[model samples]
Target: MPLQFQDRVVLITGAGSGIGRATAVKMASLGASLALCDINYDNLESTSKLCGATTPKHLDDVDVSSNQEVRKFVDATATKLGRIDHVFNCAGVNPTSIPLEDTTDEYWDKLVNTNLKGVFNVTRAAIPHLKSGASIVNVSSISGLRGSAQQAVYCTTKYGLIGFSKCMALELGPRGIRTNVVCPGYIDTPTNAGIVKGGEAVERMVNGNALGRLGTPEDVADVVAFLFGEESRYMNGSVVEIDGGIKGTVLGGQERAKL
Candidate 1:
């Protein structure tokens, strides 16, 4: 049977852009009732329109780092939508590359709060509303799997998410709720516009992937949708990579370029 989410309610963070926005549109097309939020109200509104939501009461400006805001939004979604069947934790901040020695306390706190604590706040608040078969997908990055220079704090938060999701899976699996993670590598999103604006940086990334192309938001969204459906009901605490085969290339960078 084809995948369908009719009458299901899905709450999506970072619904303003990139993978989150793409997922919102995809789920809406599949007949899901959506509740979306983002720090940017304008972009959030645009995403709501794309989803064709008639009323946007459950959608608003929400800073995921704030527990109070997260709790309020979660309650509103449960109250307005009658239930929350799935949660897509896609809200996160792009990391600024800087040497470890130059990393400021302020910058570290910013990344930790949004990338790590934000997921905590949402999951904590939504746990009460979620019932059997509910799925929670947290977005991490390829940086979580391995180390990268000048990305200490970013890697920390992403790596923490993997651990956190696994724990949630163990705790909630008995209750029939599944938790999972998606790690995307070099996706061509607006958040990475500067890096992909046309230069050696973009070319290097394209070559790094075995598929020889950067992943798109839709690419990740399709996988997210599958995880939410029954096709992946047995999947829990799984860390899925949506990077166009970046994890499979065995050749050195110089040698791989020849292919």
Candidate 2:
């Protein structure tokens, strides 16, 4: 039988585009009711339409970095959807990469607050409303598992997510709630548009990965769905890497080139 979410109530942050949007569409197709939010109203509306959700209560313009806004959104989702069975904490930002010395306080603050603190705010607020069998899937990056060049702030935030999710997993486990983090590599999303347009850079990235191609939002969404379902019932406090084996052989590529 196919995986199904017949009556599940799912709350997805960053549901405007990319993986979040894909997940929303996928879950909706599987019969899950969605409460989606993003900072971009236009994109959020587009996603809602794509999911065929016409109700105003199903969508919101929420900045995950703000505790008050997150609280309001979560409260509204619970009020509208009744209860949240799964949460996809996918709202995040990726500023231009620069060397550590060149990084500004403003840039660092923006990334940290949105990426790290954002996840915390949403998850913290939703915890009280999450049912016993609830699942929380946080979207980290391959940079979280391993450092990247000229991405000190971004890496820091991603790494923080891993630790934060692990702690939540442990604490929520006793209550039958599961928390897991997904680390994706070079996914073909708006955030990586620059690299995708840079012909040679894109090739280099593909060559670095064992799969020999960039991942699509759907690839990650499938895994997110798995983690949210009963198949992953025992998968608490786990860090799943959906990087197409890039992390395993990234350094090996350098060694081979040196040879």
Candidate 3:
């Protein structure tokens, strides 16, 4: 049986890499039409080439942090695609994980604007055109639910995304729109490749989680695909955790196992 989503118009921001790239390709594989936008034109085109070749319909270079740009992109998407049915608010950033004292004004502003305000801008712009029964998936992070030792700004932004998703669901569910958040744990993507490849961090991360393996972009994409369905029809304002069972594991610093 077809996994549905055939011919559905799905909009995904940050369609360049990590979960966003994976989701765009996944939806297209299942036959969904796409409206992709990103700040990086090359990466966006890479995702476009990987999609179902339904003529793309829309490809926008948008600074998602700005409401005006986001609104324009959304308007263009609906105008070009005729309507939008699903939106994956997946644009985000990872600031240097350093001590709070080391964080600067520019760093905080940049992180929040891209990671938090970006989500808000896209969702707000798309709300009017989101058809009834449509779904909106916000890409949050494990840091949103828990603390990260050196990622305060990043954590704060993701945590804010979770809150935004909840409030969005409350306001939009009445109109048959569903909003939800997905918090991914240590996904091994190009975005996090630097940290994941470090010898010490890699060994420790492996032993710390139940799965004993880092998450792939596709692992998160699978959950996103499920949430975009009737299986998750009743799941609104919900926070779906995709943390490799790390949330339930005991918290501590343990010696890394020899690989």
Candidate 4:
């Protein structure tokens, strides 16, 4: 059966690339109205166009770290759209390998602000506008569950998302607002375009998982769509892992060196 999200207003951050872009298209195909946000204007507009959305306004330069900005963005989206049903927090950064000892204050702050606090700011602003039974999906990573060398900052932010989602689920479930985390494995997108630029990351992902290949944005988007629809009405406060089951692969080995 086709999943219908007709007229449902979905606000998605990081709508310019990767899983976020895929999710926007998927929902839009199902007739969902969308408010797409991203720091990259061109790609964000491209995604909106691909969805064939009318009134697809783009918001570039949103600093998710600032509560004021987050509130303003949500208010603006809601004012423009009139209603909000689903919110996807997907903007994030995975900087190059840098030792924790060598990590600077600026580097760490940006990561934390965008990754962890970013989700918090957006979700917090949208909560009041969310109708009962509305859903919030936070984009987390397997890095939160497990760790990687030289990725202390990334790990911390993702792990924090998991914790934040669970608490929101608990606090808002009674109001019929569902909160959940979508923890995707390695997915090919512009964020990690550097890795596949040389074909090295693809090779590691192919050998690292039970699926024997890297995950496409559509793969993750399918899961996200389910969470946003009636199919998952009873699912909340859950951490759904979408990796190829590479939980035990050797850290930084050839299995997932690309990540």
Instruction: List candidate 4 segments past 4 Å from native.
Output: 1-3, 53-60, 250-259
- The predicted structure with the larger TM-score, 1 or 2, is 1
- Candidate 3's displacement at residue 237, Å, is 0.7
- Tens digit per residue, CA lDDT, model 1, 1-259: 3438987899999999999999998888888888899999899889888888553336889999999999999999998889999999999987766788999999999999999999999999999999999999999888778776677888899999999999999999999999999998777776674354558767877887889887788889989999999999999999998777785432221211100
lDDT of 4 by residue, 40-104 (tens): 78888788788874634535557678888778888988888788899999888765567889999
- The full ranking of all candidates by lDDT, starting with the best, is 1, 2, 3, 4
RMSD of 3: 3.8
Report the Cα lDDT for residue 201, model 2. Answer: 64
What is the TM-score (0 to 1) of candidate 1?
Answer: 0.92
RMSD to truth, every model: 4.2, 4.4, 3.8, 2.4
lDDT of 2 at 57: 35
lDDT of each: 0.84, 0.82, 0.80, 0.80
TM, every model: 0.92, 0.92, 0.91, 0.92
Instruction: Give Cα distance to truth, residue 181, candidate 2, Å.
Output: 0.6
What lDDT is obtained when candidate 1 is compared to the true structure? Answer: 0.84
Backbone collision tally, model 2: 0
What shift in Å separates residue 165 of candidate 2 from its native position after superposition?
A: 0.4
- State, as a TM-score between 0 and 1, how close model 3 is to the true structure: 0.91
lDDT of 2 at 13: 92
